[model samples]
Target: MTIPLPGLDLQQLGPEQSLRAFIGWWPDAQTRLYLAEQAVQAQVIYGGRMMHADHFHLTLAFLDGSSVSVLQALAENMADWPVPAITLDLTLRDVFEKPQVVWAGPDESQRQALTVLDQWHEDIWARLTALGWTQPPRRFRPHVSLLRHARIAADQSHRHALPTQAFVGDGVGLIVSVPGEQRSQYHLAATVNPGRAVS
Candidate 1:
């Protein structure tokens, strides 16, 4: 009797076990610098673990339950959707504990972005549902994730507020990452450039 060993490609198995997608803003250099400094200081002061500064992003939408190809197509369409560059001014309202996670609340502008994104999520959700996909259970929030897990004390909050920076989202991208890795790094599977119509 001959037995066959399963041949697997590790690269195909990423930090995540499921197919995940998110629409977010990638900050420019100046914004990245300011956030990095704040994260470092927060780490020392609050003892809260800091996310990789280079990976800092503002997630607008999250979706699961679609194939990579489907997500890629969605991203391609979004990149082609014509929309003006959105300018946001973020102000931290307060620090709040929501069950398992701690997050920084956003001001009016951030809330506005949340509203816009919520509508977009609905639109995408309908499309995916039509394609026979189930969505995740998490409710949408416009806040930025400051620290995760309670291992870090409340004292770890940054003494100085994070400075504000502006960025124009040039395109929408499809990103995928594996689970259990030290960092969840994503590659641009597709790029949807703004100010253009979908083909």
Candidate 2:
């Protein structure tokens, strides 16, 4: 199978047995590079494993281990899943210490945008639940994981201020995650445009 985006070639990503997919929005090349640089900076400040820049994405829903037929059906059905274009301002650098994750996400300043993202997530989750997929029992929080296994002291851990970086997303992708020792590899199996579906 072959799927092509502006700078991505899915043919090279190879095949998958089951569609262990998630619905998410992918950033463009420039935003990707910026995220990677932020990861590097975070790694320098807090000792941890920095994520690959190419893997940076805003995940909406996790749909694990569905069949390829389901992927096809979802792609077709998503033409009616009209998502408005959203600009995510990455201004907050925070940590999920229990998970040892250092991440970036929209701050309180972008409350309206965050509200939109929350609603979008709820809409996708509802659709997935109706499809009989088990929902993970966690509140939706839109974040781009920058680094993993970060160790910080109690007083040292706080939200870091950074110059606002923006990522504009107009579509959602059905992405399959391939496991790896260093970092998980993600392949874009299909996409649902704000106005249409592309596969």
Candidate 3:
């Protein structure tokens, strides 16, 4: 059975804001710049914390408050797990006002890829659950966050056209993130790709 380690909680992780691990995809340089531009614009115009360019990603699964021990255990358990590589196409933007954030996600045309990604997420969740980890409560939403804790005008909120962007990730990865001043910062912990050697 997997033992939950509370000692390494976000509060225990010093100044970082979150105490969770996640399966996520980091964007390539060009994609990062494009996304950062959007986040920067939102922050500058609406007043909010801009996500650091280096940490731009689309989350696959949110592992709620897993401590170092559990994460290490899970990493070891999934050391050789192969995650297929996929190119996610995102072309729409929206503001989740209650949470005060801006994000972008795939449009209808990209539904096939999004469906595969969602299935991949489910498979991962099942594996982790079998390994003794508790399931996360939030439903999966295949989107990359731009600016968090944002304050946007009503007219500026909700869905709109975002320029086309695509990223072909090498593999899936587990990111270790902690709470940050402006936003939670992330650290890539474990990753695997059936398409290539384990990284």
Among all candidates shown, the one with the greatest lDDT: 2
**Model 1 off-target regions past 4 Å?**
1-18, 72-77, 82-84, 93-105, 109-117, 135-137, 150-162, 167-170, 179-181, 194-199
- TM-score against native, each model: 0.63, 0.79, 0.79
Per-residue lDDT of candidate 1, residues 149-185 (tens digit): 4344454543234455443233444555534457555
Q: Please count the clashing residue pairs in each candidate, in the order shown.
A: 9, 0, 4
Writing each residue's lDDT as its tens digit, candidate 2 over 1-199 gives 1122332233443334464778877776666778888888888878988877667777888787776666666666664675755667888889887888888888877877888888888888788777667789887888888998887666565689877888755346777776669656777656665444221
lDDT of each: 0.49, 0.72, 0.68
For model 2 the local lDDT of residue 45 reads 79
* Residue 166, candidate 2: alpha-carbon lDDT: 84
Best by TM-score: 2
Model 1 worst lDDT run, 10 consecutive residues: 1-10
lDDT of 3 by residue, 38-97 (tens): 787667755777777776777777787766666776666775775655667778887777
Runs in model 2 lying further than 4 Å from the true structure: 1-19, 67-69, 154-156, 180-183, 194-199
Estimate the overall C-alpha local distance difference test score of candidate 3. Answer: 0.68
Candidate with the larger lDDT of 1 and 2: 2
Cα RMSD to the true fold for all candidates = 9.1, 4.6, 6.4
Please identify model 3 stretches exceeding 4 Å from their true place: 1-19, 153-157, 179-184, 194-199
Clashing pairs in 3: 16-179, 17-179, 17-180, 18-179
